[model samples]
Target: MKNVLLVLFLSISMIIIYVFIPQQQSIVFQPNDSNANMAYIPTKEETQFKIKYTHSIHLTDVVESYKITPSKKIHQYELMYEDFSIGMPSNAEEGETFEVLNGSYYIKNMKRIFPFFHLRIGQVRANHTVIFKNVEYPLSHSIPPGTSVKVEIRTLNFIDLWKGVNILESL
Candidate 1:
């Protein structure tokens, strides 16, 4: 009887594990010390993106409190910047571009999101473009000094949605 029970438990455990686990791909960024930040905190109703600051900079008159509004399929939360990062890749200027493939972004030291692919940037500035998989986004923002800008990363996967927290200083 004990043998039969043990076999049954093992079978059940195997079935559960097979049905629940997702295949996750992990990649580490080079230089291995790029700074990233979450500019804002998400509210209960907000379910799309989270923001943070990669560096500690000053911002002015930025929106302190906000809520998620209506959307069609994807809701975009805009984090108006006061003072944004002036970070650029080696030799990159206010109008140059770069790319980081197989890149990994860690939020608040907990959740990790890896894109299927990446694209090169078209320009560089305090506010530049970040193109990934044909989707163009901003690299930096324009905000007031002493104020921080918020970044809005998608919250699609259910597991990654609830792990919102402030972005750390470095990735």
Candidate 2:
């Protein structure tokens, strides 16, 4: 009788821990450390997100669009930049399209996939912006300067989401 009761108890505990507490998926910008205050949760969609930053030397805007696959891999689809100077890409690789539209250069049909990428917040000139859900956010507002944030998708529970940062409250 005691053995059966123990098994039941364990099963219930496991269900409560795994099922009772719901999990939410979001693109998390976690810094080098486990400092949740420095982290940012931009969106819950596993569809698309964008990172826009200004060139340090040229001071022109550069936008990179990424799509999150169903398997959680990040797929870079397009890149838009002001010009072709100061380390900017001149032409697209094999099968990619390089075109000019409205005085800007666009490299479309990108096929680069990565598990995750590190984004080091610029101390001086990099005005990095996170755009998703038709909104733009200033990344420098939450994280400290020069912090290398690991950008990835994380399945966070309520406690984790509460601890992490969310800059979309007003919207």
Candidate 3:
């Protein structure tokens, strides 16, 4: 009878301990160290091109512009050409004349659509000419007998994360 009572008491004590004792939950807290700002910073490079041509051609209109801004805080804009031999040849027709105009291709405005995606938009300025013989040549006509211009273009480059680990490791 004593052993039975002792067993019952021990079981009751165990139940009380199980119900009253506070259990600790295991929780883990980790922070992300590689985010867009830290991992995916953009870079820029300067590209050069040498254009040399001599031919009789006609030019009506030429438009040049560039705009690349992945985020509102960062912007990359450039004008037509850095250096040029843009002018009319001395042997142009008696009434032949040309005009070189300087202007901004792409104006920077604070506008951010997608922060991650970036694009380059612009046109490289080139020397061109048009020849009008005995016919009545309008003032708008432009002719270049010879052209030798050095063009420098600036571009924005970003690291693509979707590439495989080997590519990333090489970079």
Give Cα-based local distance difference scores for all models. Answer: 0.29, 0.81, 0.25
Error of 3 at 122 (Å): 47
Clashes of each: 22, 0, 6
Off by over 4 Å in 3: 26-171
> Which sections of candidate 2 miss by over 4 Å?
1-22, 33-38
- What would the per-residue lDDT of candidate 2 be over residues 1-171, giving only the tens digit for each residue? 999999999999987787547477677788876453645554565388899999998999999999888877789999999978878999999989999999999999999998889998888888788887768887877677777889887677666667777756523
Where does candidate 1 have its weakest 10-residue lDDT segment? 24-33
Number of the top TM-score candidate: 2
List the candidates' TM-scores in order.
Answer: 0.23, 0.83, 0.16
Model 3 residue 13 CA deviation (Å) reads 0.2
TM-score of 1: 0.23
Ranking by lDDT: 2, 1, 3
Best-performing candidate as measured by lDDT: 2
lDDT of 1: 0.29
Q: Which of the two candidates, 1 or 2, achieves a greater lDDT against the reference?
A: 2
lDDT of 1 by residue, 1-171 (tens): 999999999999987665555322111111112233222222334333322233323322221111233321222223333333453213323332332323421111112222312222123222323222233333333222232323332332223322322222211
